[model samples]
Target: MSPTMTEQIVLTAREARDVPHGEKGKFYERASERLGISTATLRRGIRSAAPSKERRRRSDSGRYALSREEALLISATILHAQTRDGKRIKTLKDAVRMLREKGAILAARIDKDTGEILGDLSDGAIARAMRGYHAHPDQILAPDPVTELRSNHPNHVWQVDASVCRLWYLEDGLQAIKRDAHYKNKPKNLERADRFKVTRYVVTDHYSGWVYARYVRGAESGENLCAVLIDAMQNRGDRDILRGVPEILMMDKGSANTAGMTKNLCQALDIRVFPHEKGNPRANGQVENGNNLVETTFESDLRFYTVRDLSHLNKLARMWRIRFNAERLHSRHGRTRSMAWLDIRQEELTNAPSAAACRNLATSTTVKRIVSSVLRVRLGGREYDVSQVPGVLVKGPLDVAYDAWGDEHIKVVRTGKDGRPVHYMAPLAKRGAGGFFEGAALIGEEYKRKKDTPAQTARAEIEEMITGERTKRGAEKARKEKRLPFGGTIDPFRGMSEKDARPYQVPTGRDHPAIAPTVESPRLTPTRLAMLLRDRLGRDWPEDGYQRIVARYPDGAPEESIPEVMAAVTGKKATPDLRVVKA
Candidate 1:
């Protein structure tokens, strides 16, 4: 048992005075330790006439102490103490390793941002210093060297991740919204309702802090995560604006990120994907901080009944995205994502071209084809209509080909009669695969499929035979065959089965008229005859309506200044009705 501190202090004071003058203070400390009185208390008690109020106060002050030489020995002890291998520091001695080092020690605090020392004190109470306090021989702590590595350009690097939403559903019999409102002294109906448990992937521009959130089924699979990421990048007009891919992709080493498919996809895209170190999630502090806010901000209201229905949950996540990017202020930027994104690149935005720069891009006109009034279209908008087929089912995969301006043309390729290439309008619904094809630029298979088919080969052969009819041989044969089949004793039809009942007739040579009959000819309008004359005379097409002019000369007409020809043709004026109308 420890003795009364007052008794111990008086004994130490008495011993100090009795000892030789050279050893007075040392002797007093030794005697105080033997008597269980603190050296500080002994010194103060001896300073006054009686060991009273002042003695008690001083004793309390010197509960933890060591002399100058003793401090150096303790510092050496701290420097060499064997710490428990994996255990974290909990006490002052454990923190500074005071049990192993014996040297003069001082208390210190280092800056969080810059590692420089904020304060230091050389004291004999080194082993008894507070937990956060540190002892160093130098005047201050060292500065961190990594602050100079910040990025300088916009879109230089973007951090992407999937995280849970921060919205919650509380199922208290008294509706959560109403309960909150009631507690706040407002009407129950005044509180806003919320949904919970939707998983979303958040992307943040490292430099600008611009964020985009997309609700996904889950981030458990590499395919789902990759699909969401690709969609977001394309939608933001990244390919149009940057014209290149990101240099680095930072992610954690989850199964989704480290899977073989993910590795192959990243390699194909030429992106360097890096994983954070194990046990140090703070390595991705920017994204981790965003996640912390997501989880912590709505912790009180979150309630997950079951993981079945994610529709309402997904809707709430989408709403939070608008709030997070458009309304919430970031500590680093001191502004919302919209404001910061513009402010960061204001120079480039101001200097870029206006209307004249956009002339190089192409545009398209859209047309519609109505069938059964149902109006089913596979395409996105009501545009692009100049070449639409009304009632034919198009075959093959739909392709979305874009010009420089992002104008889309839905096209399909088919073989022609000559076994050559032909292009046709592709069905709209089949064109883009709902924008999934755009990601193909960044992450699709590398090979293009060949378009030849067996049907095309058969058609090619038939067309070749039709074109190569021998002129000499076929003409002579046709002349010989023109003779009456019964007189010439030749069969009237060729390649007919003997059992057929129908008989064919061959034309009688020399009996056929030298010129074809004219009475049976389809009647040609005066306008048609005049058009033929104008074309034969090398005149441009007339702009006037021919139907109106034909009303005056319905039968025939003579060319102006061709009077002799008109008389030879039995006409009064050029028009057939000139006699009746003129009279």
Candidate 2:
């Protein structure tokens, strides 16, 4: 039989290994020719078929002399020495030396048998042990995992954020907050300029990346927040496409954002307010990035251009924002923000109310007032005639909201039969001379009265049943004569009085049976009883043993009777007076 190629290769490799080191190449060349293969192939085959060299390992390989606690202490020391910016000032060796000086770690390991000291501790060894135990600075300081968010549509989610523009302030005009000898970033300079500092409010649509920015003088407040939000929501102009109310408004948990005024505005607009957790600005990163963009792209031009006042700055900002949204291509959608937002369907976009109405909604709180006898309600120091509003009754409490569009009228909110709010615009009542309503009939010329509400009719029926009169005058006369509302024909305490007056025969002492003494037993949980049984039996306890015990004593076993019960279940003799101790 002829030798196989593998066997020839193996024989060649054996011969090559025995050849002198310098002549192995020549030997491989000769073998390649004989084997009808290239020299490189023959060498590779020889290398593969030859036995691999054994690398010796030390006795203490893969072992660390430093304990996990010592490594952790060293890592903690190094971490503690880091600056606020996370720059490490101390190295591992420095940490080990410091720890040794403080006696937190030993300088060397001592042998337990001979008390002989080993070599000085190695920083490299400590570092390796730290990496092995996951106590290194990189491992401990790793960032938490982040979750990416998605938006369904342009107006589905909007992020609003406020940031202080540290560059400029609006005093007489736009002035730079220069960091010079006179106006450094000291407490005095910052405190004096705090009121005049420009706060930039930015709103970004999460899906389209369209940004709306407005510059406000002074610090952030609920009024400023509402003003910016209103401007962003309302129609800007024909050219600007970012308008309408968003379904969800996401912001930080700032006091101004979560204030009652902001909440009321969002509620009135039917927008859900979502405040992200504290210290997590990434939740609203879109707006945060919008702020940065505004600062870099728009505000960066302020150095060359002139900004007369906050209004002027806001005007320029709006213009730049519109152009940017209409021109710049968004990286995510690969189109201009305006074009992306234009994809919104008419039904998906909710048209916002007028600026005045939105402002009123944000600033004013809903109030409750009862309609007067003349079918009027007072709101915002103005009396409105609600007589024309359906379901409104005299002296009935109605939910009234301010009408920002006109001071001559107010909105009356009422719950309809379907449990939804029905709004009515109630016009302000005109008062005639002598404090009478203008629409009222003259004293002698005419006579007119409002129709009675359902409550009034019910009251009239009650009066007729009680005082035997349907007219208000007659009902008043009956009331003056001391007539009760229910006609004074019923007694409320008759049954109680009859029962108190009735006599009952008392039971004789002999008729009562003797009372038996009842013994109270402490309740034991299934696990507790199982544990006790296991400890007493000193053997493996099955789950069925607990089931049997529960079935026998559903209420609980008395502590004193535990021994007898255990003995009976285990088929062993009961111990004398053995009681289970309360744990």
Candidate 3:
């Protein structure tokens, strides 16, 4: 029996290894001709091949076809041909041609027995295999590895995530209410706050792409997250058809999500918390996908609406949501998100938490703080004076329970193991008013502000003027009396003239010229001279002394010494070039 081409190459290389160094090249050349293989192939197999390769018979199959090992080598070579940093690397096509060099056999061959092609791997095939290996992990090791998630109904699982929005909103609305602390009057502070983008808390239905959202000023707190959740669950109208307490609140391990208070609140409401591992948000891909929708579609629509404040942003977002859930079609079902949600809602038994169940429940949020020497504790944005509590010894940090929604004032106290209220954590009185009964009113105002028409806004301004302002005369007095950003009045009159003291007012008529005393006349004597001063002193005088002007005037009756008194003590001036003397 005769050895096949691959067998002959193996045998030749084995024998060539024993040949003298000077005769190795000539032997390889002779072997290439006899075996119908390239000298380079013979040289490579000789250098890199193992000594124990199996032989093939002339009558056996795979006579002209490349082996699995050969195929892999060719694929690697093709992959190496890809460009590196714009430098010319070998091309895959050129690399493949090297396999078919002159006198070299191709990987595939037509069998003479059945006229069938065996092990037919093309250059294109090799290139594809190579690129796939380098580009993806496990493509070669374990191909098509995926675990598809199955959500049978809406709210079966809700994925929640927070992403900073891409664009800044106009700060004019947020700036309407000034913040004394945090970004106070800093240069570009408002711009920076807006440019940095507000955080958007998104809740997405896993079964449907239905989404709910809230945009806030800073990082999400535990209470804020719960509050946002409440909004998502509360069904405002038929348009808000996606409302329901999710069976599972899937989220990342953010401080807001992981806080004990947040867990307690959800547990009380019978909502399961499914937090992903610290770094993996893809676990809750529903919300992540929602983020993409926001970036592409919602944000694109925002170009038309003004983002002045949270209310405005939320209003626009709500309208966009309606369109997104009802009008826009989903790729998976060829139906809208709202349609999908309604379809699932038909069969699913939803257990949405009631308003009564959630009210005042956010008070579980607790923090520890040490009382300063001033007998006060600072919580949220307000300070409480414990000084009135009288004769309390110095103490370290105290556990304080506060309103998570900021809808109530904080009470300094310790909580039981179950997070129930215990005794007073610290002896202190509630210092100031917080988000209480009027919180709803404030929210309504914000909503109105956002949706206000030109007429409504003007009317609101007029009402504000009526309520926050005084009578014209009183307003004048109030404007002159300087106060603070918060309260209390003092004479801020130091740096201002009388006109400047009343900045909001514009002068008219005689008041247009300042009420300051002029050189022609100073203060009225308050005696009988008051009539004389009030009646005749305003006339403009000449550049010379007042005596020249007074002398040219007619004298009063002999009974009245007022004219002589005025001539003796006062000046009447009618001067264009005259200047007022300082009083």
Candidate 4:
């Protein structure tokens, strides 16, 4: 008959407390198994509910007391067996044997009658217990090698990796903050703490040569790898530049890349994974080259103490990547990364959904504010009012962009300029009823200056003012240097053929050197000298300078060494009348 619940509880407590002291440690496991409960639950319930003091049992002895390590080992054995393979090691005798195989020591009873181990313990028991814990051949999961992945545009396959760097944290000015009651800066002398372990993960576009890099504590962890990828995707200037989530990510079999949890996350996001052969890890050559380039830039030029913190190193990595892609020229692409990207992606970019639709929902965005309202925004310790117009605002960050035109002004907050987002009021005087085109010029300027200044209205106004001044100066110069109206008659040089353009004959020492009358006083100017020489020796005039000018009269021969020398020698001040030549 099955024991009642109360009776089972009583028996479990009795085993834990009244079992001979020499056997008390072993009783919990045996009693828990027999009573159909966990050792932990049984121990807890008995310790709390059972009578603490008991009459000394005759079998009580010190030899069987369970040490802490032994208890932990037994508990670990039970837990390990509780997994899918748990049921196979069901009996206490089996559990003890498994524990011994896992480096535990124990004794067992045997039956003299059938030569079988009694209560499930016997010779080779440890080996038998290990058999149940052994993993099946089919249980191992292997990585699948993907041979190919095709992409039509940028961001298709962003490769990531890590490297070490030494960084120096500036402290001189950082010290002032500690003294200032209002200052809340972190404690200084940070660079003195040497030896930072830096890891850099870079994502390079297969097509555009554009790359993004981040300094992480280590790229070996799934968390940091995921972070760098997300950072690259989110910070890109053009989000829709990607055709879709990358079709495949080519990576080596690094711990971070092949982590089960990370792999699962990638699957959930529909990112296919392709790992390179174990020994041959160069499948992602682009990003590896990117790391080298980063090293060249930082290791060669920028000196640092050590890349101690991941986030700080990442910030520096971002700055370096921006410079590498936007400003630095690459020999392979024969242009800047930005230029190459624009060359291949311009058409696709034009066709992408409007920037308004592409703004990420996650980040605090720039918003446009009118001049009538002063926006209260602070960044990096400075304060500014946003221009009242259509600007970008990162929701609650108090950052604002002013766009008096259609394209928002907040877009210009990228690096290279004042990286912080700008906030300025639109000038009321300039507000006019010009359609989107009227605003388009400002919009274009803002787009061009996105990586320049963060202040929306200030940048716009400065561009407009500078442009107006240049235009006015140009118009005044044009008006002052007047040109004659077109003449009704066309008689001479129109449609002249090459045959009509005879060689400019000039006097040589071999031909007419004696009769070629030299001018009493040479005209210093090229035009005057050429004419005087041509008239004196009509068929023997030097043709060098005159011939070049005559070929393209208005455009004129370039005022180079030949003309300058002729003018210097001739004493005449007249400019070169590049139109005339003697043949």
Which lDDT values do the candidates have, in the order given? 0.46, 0.83, 0.60, 0.49
Pairs clashing within candidate 2: none
Best by TM-score: 2
Clashes of 4: 43
lDDT of 4 by residue, 269-370 (tens): 335577777755457777778778876776555443443344555666666666667777877657877766655443433222222322222123344322
- Residues 135-198, candidate 3: write the lDDT tens digits: 3112333334446677878778888898766554446653322354236567576556655447
TM-score of candidate 4 on Cα atoms, chains taken together? 0.29
* Runs with alpha carbons beyond 4 Å of true place in candidate 4: 1-151, 166-196, 236-244, 304-310, 343-583
Provide the global lDDT of candidate 3 against the true structure: 0.60
Better of 1 and 2 by TM-score: 2
- The C-alpha RMSD of each candidate to the native structure, in angstroms, is 33.8, 29.2, 27.5, 34.2
| Model 2 / residue 261 / CA error / Å | 1.6
Task: Give the Cα error of residue 559 in candidate 1, in Å.
Answer: 99
- Poorly placed runs, candidate 1 (over 4 Å): 1-149, 162-200, 215-219, 236-245, 296-308, 342-583
* Alpha-carbon deviation at 310 in model 2, angstroms: 1.9
Clashing residue pairs in candidate 3 are 413-425, 540-573, 540-574, 541-573, 541-574, 541-575
Candidate 1 TM-score versus the reference: 0.32
Which model is ahead, 3 or 4, in terms of lDDT? Answer: 3
